[model samples]
Target: MNHFFRKPILLITATLFSGSIINAQNVGIGTATPQLGKLEVKGSTGAVSAIFYDQSTGVAIENNHPGIGFNSYYNGGRKAIAPGFGGLLGMDPASGKLHIYTAPASIATAGAPMLLTERMSILANGNVGIGIAAPTAKLDVAGNLKIADGTQGEGKILTSDELGNASWQSGASLVPGASIGYGTWGDCATNGNIGAYQPLTGAAGVNNFGKSVSLSGNYAIVGAPFETVGSNYSQGTASIYRLDGNGWVLMQKLTDATGAAYEHFGSSVAISGQYAHCSYCRRPRRKWRAWFCNHLSIQWQHLAAAKNYANQPCKPGFLWQ
Candidate 1:
């Protein structure tokens, strides 16, 4: 008899459970008639709409929600609304801080569903990241940022004004022959020959002076690769000049100690600090060499001299200063 009564009670419990499942519909937490969604929570002015708590893990999870959660508070008789702001809200189990994420929206169609893009999250450590999953700094952006002010140009720099506003400003000029207001004004062909000085003796076409020139500090070097020395033709020479007061005075003339005919000694010239470098390219013997000069001690030293092998082609060599 006891077993027969227990069987009837089990059948009644199963019938009542199935009925509850069939009658399940939209649930309204604080409203009489909820919206078309599965669940809806409504609040009054100056009041929080909902608060979820999970005592098991100390983290709350809200899924498939629309609109911002904590932005509906009244402020100074004004209601500021943030539209289309919805995401997941959770609490970090370790730090107990809130984490908010903006959820991606979607649109349903007959063929496919299109998802709308949105920002990811604000981390529990207060770091915000855009276009990145993990941010290592305070505000980390993984993409390029372009400032679209009308005053900016190609090579201009971004600068801040006294009012703390940032704008673009012109950078420093870096072009050669830029006049910066510190030179005497006169034409090259008609300068009154104020401080002009040339070789004491040279014919019209033989003197190829000022072919190569280098200036550093107060020193200048000029090369003449076709200047004749004694009876030799094209025995090149170099001249060093110093800036004395407002004029350039010739300090010394440099020539190879064992200079021969057709050796273009001063084809290239460079100066740095108190030293000068000159090159000699001997075309006939296929030989190339460079010499170093110390302007302070008035000493010359042969640094490199190399002769190409017979029947071997050669290219122009470079000398480092």
Candidate 2:
């Protein structure tokens, strides 16, 4: 049974029993006037404001789903929180789905109501949704996602490691240079084949590139016998490449400086280790000239030294017909 005591000006009512006070429909502790809601407790300096204790041993909400609800009469609405042994649990009562919401501001005054935005949701079937209410997949997100692991780039793709960890990686750039064919002369002339190596600078032209090619380990040398240098037609050149993470990259372009037009400097090429040799028919000397380039240094000044092997006997592997 509760009794009411009416003050002259305040009109206060209360029923006190064993230090507990109940006034009409409102309950107040350490305060006579509870202005905010039905139940209010005003705590002093050295004490805790409020505490919710659960007696359950396991990590689950066993009994009734008890929660505190907040509502406003203005434009905004209600936000409920259910505190339990499994941390803070927020759920939609009608759908029984776990929903997480965030408010833009901390406080909401009289006229201006608080707006709550739902950020994440976990369905009853264990499907998680981000930026969306209903999820069709196991983990569904409506917005764009970025995985920054230092290997991500614009033109890269995701690749998995040995342990199934994924990271962004670059693929080889297949810039078409020329076509190579195999078989008899009639078959090579009629059927067009596919495959080529990248040029030193830009795209390769109608020059007879890949007419002669030599490979030594991860290094390769290709001959462009009909390549024109400056005003000299068919002066010819050879390109050397080294294989790396980004496929074969052009290292240097080899050419005979003292050779004249129609000499075809890179007619035939051979590469053994770091040494590269290129031979061509010298029409002026009526004999073949070869440039034995020693890639022993990074400067690549060895290609400038041309050697005339006119009188010397032709070595078996070095000189290819």
Alpha-carbon error at 285 in model 1, in Å? Answer: 0.9
Provide the overall lDDT of each model, using Cα atoms, as 2-decimal numbers.
0.55, 0.61
Number of the top-ranking candidate, with TM-score as the measure: 2
Q: RMSDs, each prediction?
A: 19.4, 17.5
Model 2 C-alpha lDDT versus the unseen true structure: 0.61
Q: After superposing candidate 1, which stretches have Cα over 4 Å from the reference?
A: 1-186, 189-205, 297-321
lDDT of 1: 0.55
Scanning candidate 1 in windows of ten residues, the lowest lDDT window is 55-64
lDDT of 1 at 174: 51
